[model samples]
Target chain A: MAEKAKILIIGAGKCGRALVELFSKIEKITIIGVVDFNQDAPGIKLAKTLNIPTAVDYREFMNKAGLNCIFNSTGKAQIEEELMLSKPAGVEVIGGCSVNLIQELIKEREKVEQQLKGLAQRRNNVVGNIDAGSTPIIPKMEPPDFNKQVKKDEDFWGKDKLIESIIQNSAVATFVINSQHKVLYWNVACEELTGTKAKDLLGTSGHWKAFYSHQRPCVADIVIDNSFVDLDKFYKVYRGSTLIPNGLHAEDWYSKLGGKDRYIVFDAAPIYDTEGKLIAAIETLQDITERKKAEDELKKAYTRLKEMQNQVIQAEKLNTIGQLASGVAHEVRNPLGIILQGVNYLENKIPAKEGDVFETLTMLKDSVKRADKIINTLLDFSRFTNLDLRPEDINSILESSLSLVRIKFESSNIDIIPEIKKDVPKVLADRNKLEQVFVNIFLNAIQAMPEGGNITIRSYGKKLEGIENGTSRREEGYFMIGEKVVVVEIEDTGVGIPEENLKKVFEPFFTTKGLTGGVGLGLSVTKNIIHMHRGIIYAESRFGHGAKVTVILKIAE
Target chain B: MDRKRILVIDDEENFTKLIKWNLEKTGKYEIRVENSGLLGFSATKEFKPHLILLDILMPDMDGSEVAFQLKCDEDTKDIPIVFLTAVAKKEEVEANSGVIGGHPFIAKPVELEQLIDVIERNAY
Candidate 1:
């Protein structure tokens, strides 16, 4: 019932023997005939036992047989002699030779695949996602079967045979890592990929030990480091002199193996036992050199697109802010002028009733002062746009900010304990901007503890590192201390910002108070200022446990 | 506890004048005004007012710098100074005022009733 190719052979010597054995193994190709001039040809007995047609003469076999294709495995110097003799007799003769027909099958498959890939590449590549050439209209579905997949997956991967089968059959390296990230199981393909045999890698924490520094045995100058950057989604594709980090099951990473740079894509899935415990990640790896190249191209395009989007967003923000600023100036300036005029007007005119005249004047004066303060704040907002970066002492900045709010702190009976470091290294930043950042953070701290609690401000060099967007690769501290940095942490024993509202603090105009909602510009401005100085700011708080904000800045060269 | 005398120091002339007029209208205290920290320091010695209302942002040295100087000097250290600012950020006001020992702050565009109440509560 199945289709098979009927292949006929014209010689039964060493060539015929090779033909009979190789062609018989392939289920798709059936050897119908093996012919030899000698009765005792090496393959003749074997072919006869297998019930295949045997001929002492090629002409007799050609006269009797009907076949799709013929191979003349017999060695020949002049193929022209064989082709003329065979073609005139109405037989198709392959040029007196046999090569792997499997190669032809492979070439045809490759041709089809190449055409498809070209079409896919042209159809707008958004890697790891649906391509644009996909049909716009979706086919109708019956219903959801969430349980069908998650449940049946157990049957697909049987218990005992799971690890062995997945490892042996996978084209990519398969591995199992334990709790301490030690290699538990290393498959044969891992040997093929990393070139270190399974026996060599087993029980040796080589990946954790020397894999980072030692030059790759195969590909020179490839990054030997294979470690993970901790994040919620820690998957990323790597290339360019980088050794694919072990343990992480990201589809693939770049490594130099076999004397040439190659992309080895592998995924490691963590395996767990009952009671919902995290055991180990089962990893699978593959060589996706060409696929990686295409992916990298797509990633580059995506990054460019993201940058363009950020530029557009920032530009829009600036435009809107400019309009708001001008409107505020217009809206407040006219009233300010009116108040000025009114004060001048009141100075000359005497009201008939002297009792309330002084109170009226006082009200007008206070209102005018209030107007002036608003104008000043607006001006300050605009001027901060042009940051005047300089080497600034954070100690002085903190001291100055505290002084501004000292009166209010005392009146409210709040105890302030400043643990500021003596001789704190000066950071390269705008002094005014730094003060503003501290002031904003300090204000939030004070607001948290309304009844007045202990507030601590601590400063040190290299205290914090890897604060998102703030820490650079050139720095370390665990605050991880790879790149040296200076850090200041401010803490307050007040009601902590809620978990839900913590991230919202950095969004402009987002505030908790209904009518008292500040423009919510404080934290946003603080974040922007720190970013401007190439510094990082991070806040940690537990509900009712208070909040701590850490600012990490590089000590300027 | 006769009518307490209150001294108001600020760079804004209209603000000082307004306080002097309003505080005196209460008929509970005598009011005197100075338009600068330097002038205010001088007035403290001459007038010997019971209470001093200070403005933080002023020419010829700011209010906190003035307060720090006052705290250091023997003559004006005894007198209580209250800071009046239009600044909305409590942290800035706290940092500026907290460093100078104990002090009080009130935001401007301040309600006339709240001003009178604060003045009465803190008066000598």
Candidate 2:
């Protein structure tokens, strides 16, 4: 149904003979004639064999009927110019320089035609042999089945599209790659996670760009490479490689991705052909960053709960001790009353001339005084049940307490540094009890530095940020966020409490100053008083360095 | 001047008797020791003491309750009472000094001189 192209060759040289041989097999074109100055040219001889007419003068065949194209392969500039002028209107004259191009195109066409004819003949021979009731000759070589190969390629792309759809609709980010590490499938989740489109990544080995700034193999590439070497060099915390049912699995924390660090898991498996040959590899990704954050928060809350449980036990123990001490103190005071009156009577009856007898009576009275003081201290600890809370200036109370200890400081050769911020917020506190707390702390600081040292008191008002809970020294649920509070810090440069004894400092009857005639109820009662005022007190100290006590109280609205 | 008559109300018999002998030895006063609150209340009417020394903690009735009873009585209501108590420390008594709770108090284990000094200053 197609018209043939009429063509002529002006040169009868080797290139011309080759072009004739190449174009003779093309069905769309027919060679009309060949011409050269030599009658014995190789192309002229080849044209005779092919049953084509030959001419010595190319101009003779220039305007020949059915001639639609002319090839000037003479290699003479004069002949090409002459052919260019004399060529007919309907004919296209290709010049001498294009002879090589024409030969190359004709050679390619000849090779394709021969292959097609060979396949056609083999099919006909096989059919003929079948009709003759004979076995067909088994050829030494066989041509490839074009239809079967085309169908196989189509089926592969179809499976690829099916896999791509599955990944595209997945909730987790995923991607797939070929054996050469080329990206074959990058899904919608992958697009959102890596901020890179599938269209940009498909058919390219750029999987590392999503999780790394530099060019390196990802976990999928490692599986394909099957080289487990230097995996830690690539990932932040790789759990090594493990074999799953259909793949190799790897998990790690990747911190170098486009700006966000993420925890990722990957599964990669080698895809094989029907012959069990390796063809490609596929991998999937999952991001667990938010899950990790929730886990850390849970751990912190559980630790706080345990600390609160311990503090409740301690508070209950101290409460029991308090109840017992109160009962015993009241009962013992009456008997102590009788002994003191009897001692007074005896002292009056006995004269100073009685020497050791009167002196011994005085000793008995002194012993009774010491016993009474211990009992009174126990009562003080138990009797602090009610608090008279009022809006009082904490800074003023601190100043008054400091004045009460000024004489002790003068006698002890200690310097007092007061850094009180003016206009400190008033706190809801019992003024008498809070002043007693400060007085006890100041006296302890003086006693700690018997040689000579410095005592620093700092008072200021601030908005509460974070408050620690679950300690006996601080009452939980008493402080809230953004509540205005007054903070007082009493730091002393003296013989600091040792590290082992820091937590026991606020416990009743726990003291480091044994030689000093104290019942060890100073800090214990101070802690109780501050708790009554709905405040917190905690101590910090280094063994050789000084001790610091911080007290926090809510400011009155 | 007539020696001042003093009445001591306390649960401890030995304690009150010792105080009675000690004050009488001074030759400055006459004293009566009542070991129970009900008996002490009746003794104030019969003795008509110039000054009363009341113990805070007592059997059958507390000293504060007995003090309220004496304050209501016509014969003993005018007598200035001094509390002899061991419930408070000696330092606490000296810190408040002189009169507290509308009456004078002497902390227990009081010296003879301190006891007589409070009686002379407060007793009429």
Candidate 3:
């Protein structure tokens, strides 16, 4: 406001327009000449209306126009040229529109001009505008802790102040946890690394019990089978689990806090105390909820693709087998037809005589029967067989099984005392297979009691130990379990299975009766049948006392 | 009426022997057993058998081809051919309604009476 003269302006963009606006509104200062290459410039016209002279050529105005201070509104690109032209000629180009807008631009230019006067350095103040509530900021200096004197400082507040100094002063996030893995120290950097503030995370257990059922093989995917895995190794969780399956590195673990699903990524490192004790683990939990979701989606897509590939392969195999069936059908049918024709002719020739013709006819018929059996078996195996389950009475099956063993039982003098439980619950089973199982178990029981012993069959929910389905084992759990299942028990008074061998009896190809030339398919088929019905069978044995087998079935009601 | 003659066409020697044994021993007709389709096609013209029992599956020319060639010829066209295949299901035999100019088939490993009955029915 003190020194007034002609101020030259250049460039007619937003910056140029702003300068014209601000300077035009000012009263004393005269914008003597507005110059730009664009002859039809709006600012130039405004300058014309203001009664100031306008020129495209700076050289033309240099002689005619008198200026005290120059404001170069041209731009950064043209600033150096403008300054070189004006500054050597003893002009102050002070006010101009710039990138550093608001009041900082004005102060910065002042500092630049002061440097020419050999003024002392001036720091950039926290500036906006004074009326706009701007304030200058400057921090107080503290004495440096150079000597080792503070190392043994006795004051708790002094130590706290020291630790707080390190936390705020250093760029890294840090924490000092106790031996119990309780978080004691949390820094500002830690809060920034995780969106969680220090207050939310402090004094809480940093050891998270993670439960993920997905087990998808990507990401920093760790499977926690037990309550905990040895957290001895540190993993860099570049990617984490999310709602949407990530194709690669998609970890899907469950959260124990109300069994919610939380997606997080982390960089885990072992934490040690000042005394060098392996106390806790320090980890940064990055809220990768969005990234985890994207990852989970990708992982799910990969799994579905793999499943589709396997299905296609299986379908192709079935197609090839279907093609082969044609040739097989013709080959089988031809021989079958010939046998039929031969059998018909022999029946006509023999006329029921006990001779070569009759014997040959009978053999021919039997051969055809055997061939039919093979074809039927093949058809059954190839066809998808659904269960035709019904509520089959177990005692009826047992009785039929005993009828099959009746002749042998009497001949072998293996006495059987039937102590079958009356009013046993009927099980949902395929009648044929259940009968097969009954015959097998009955025969086994009869064989075990070769020298005549009594068999006790009981149906009760009794104690079974150390098994997941042993609901009846616990005192509080047994009575409530009757609503879930009914147990069938069969105990034989014979030389039982050995302590070491009880578990193997139900497995296929495991039979101790080697002398009887057992094919060992019975128990395996029995076990398969029982499993198909969604039941469980287990055995308890003592070498001399005898073996007791218990089967548990879900009650129909 | 002239006695019937049957030409048994089979690749296997033992099968031919057994058929020849059973048929020729009965003295019911003049029987000739040819071991191959090539030999049987020629024998059909020379033997001039009233009926031909042709085995369908063979190494060289199959029975279907021999039947085809026979029905194509003027001299052997008059003879009735019955395909005797080891692998002719009921549907397969039923499907081959008229294999060679209304000629029928009796499935193979044929019994003594059935073969005799087919011969008797087709006998000229």
Candidate 4:
């Protein structure tokens, strides 16, 4: 064999580094030295690690034995001309552009070599798998060479185009990102979902732009990072997928997708190469905006249905109690009347001058009257009498109710602030019953604030909009959307009802007042009267703050 | 003033008796008691009181039927009938100015003063 050819690379840059690595691997050539102005240049470092001679000055190696060739990679003409003039007689200097061409040819050859190695390995895997499985009978055919077989395999798999086509034509939005977090594939479905073209997104790390207003890692990026523990910090709802190992799923509401609000679900999984190395991550997206809206609507409808069911049960219970109350009233009131009349007779026959006799009879009469009052309240609570409905102004009714309780308010040191709106529409309601409702509410407010507070009564006409829930009121189609209604709100700055008791305030026999204050039927009776008028009544309170009772009645046509 | 005559018609015997005693003790009226609506109607013609204090919800006959019969008659139609019953609510009675069904009404367990006021207003 001839003597080995000694090569010298100049510039110690990327091109020079490629030349050094390539010549070092050749069997018939040896890299004699590397030269660069920068001591820390990549080629100089690599050449030093390979135990080749390196220097900041090329003249140090100029006279070395058998240094026959010099590759100039710095792209400086003055350095090339100087090297050409001072080089030994047998040595030749290749310029920067020519070195570049030689580097390209070498790189191309290495790439082809890597491809052939990979194809040979893949072919072995295929043949090995086929041998391990049960054989299938086939017609005799000629065996192809390795190159032909590799070509056939490439055509059969159509790896890149087939995967891209599958993703592009899929109805579900999908995208893939490599380990460097660069978007490798952004399919047509993804384009439609995000309103971003593939040409602008491919090879970029801007997949987050489709779902978020700011820069952030998407699910696929997180998977590629293998940072699932920090998923909660980025997503409100996220969980590990049950189907795929090392897979994750998350849901979020994006406000700016396609210029519309959308609820999106992301399913991301780590894609591994044949050697079980995580090479990339794939993420599939689903637009669940309509499904989420429907779910919310279904939730509202279920709540309404539950409220109506409770109302029907309450009405039935009240009806049963009413029947029982009427029966008891008829049976018990007659005897009470007899006792009261007897006490009156005894008072008349035995004069007041008798020792404690008139007092005793008065006490007896008082007890009888109290009993009758309770029975009357029970009767009122259970009564379902036809409303003597008439078109009447709500302001006037509120004023009348306030007037009736004015003396109580003053005595209790309570301030009455009437914010009644003028020209309020008339509501078809029984005047007496509605007056009773307001009076009961005012009395409750007064009782609530025995230490003196403010009772604000506000009345206004409004157009009904959406149905309200969880207000101790039933939406039973009594009030239509856009219907005119008179709303009366009575707010009291007193000891607010506790949150737990807010819902029970309208239930029969549920009262915060002690035994002497009331029989727990005041709000129940009030709710009944309002319902009879086809109105809604509900109470709201923040504990330790205050209580507000609102009554809504439809305006008469 | 030949004390105004009043008749008490109620199914409760003790209630009617006490009412009669209480009204007579007032010395402004003479009282008669009947236990049933049917008997009360017959006694109305016999006693010919100035006012009829009728109890509704009586078992034998309802007070409204008794009132209907009295109004249908020639002699008793002129007499005023005041309903003293447990069926009417006091608030409703007061709200309607103590009158219901074209006649005066007083809820039962009534105080003596209110009862007297209603009776005097309705009686001739």
**Each prediction's TM-score against the native?**
0.37, 0.52, 0.36, 0.59
lDDT of 3 by residue, B1-124 (tens): 4558899887766666666766665678778998888989888888999899888887788998998999899988878877786544332344454243356777554567767888887867
Query: Any idea what lDDT model 3 has?
Result: 0.58
- Give Cα distance to truth, residue A417, candidate 3, Å: 31
Docking class of 1: incorrect
Best by lDDT: 4
At residue A333, what lDDT does model 1 achieve? 47
Model 2: residues >4 Å from true position, as ranges?
A1-322, A346-365, A385-400, A403-413, A422-432, A463-485, A498-503, A513-517, A553-557, B68-80, B88-124
lDDT of 2 by residue, A203-274 (tens): 889878787678988767876787877867766555432222235556677774435787776766676654
Q: Rate the local accuracy (lDDT) of all candidates.
A: 0.61, 0.76, 0.58, 0.82
| 1 or 4, greater by lDDT | 4
lDDT of 1 at A388: 69
Q: Which model scores highest in DockQ?
A: 4
lDDT ranking, high to low: 4, 2, 1, 3
Can you give the lDDT of residue A223 in candidate 2? 69
Q: Compare candidates 3 and 4 on DockQ and give the better one.
A: 4
Query: Cα lDDT for residue A267, model 2?
Result: 60
Ordered by DockQ, highest first, the candidates read 4, 2, 3, 1
Candidates 1 and 3: which is better by lDDT?
1
Q: Give the DockQ of candidate 1.
A: 0.04
Clash statistics: count for each candidate: 41, 0, 23, 0
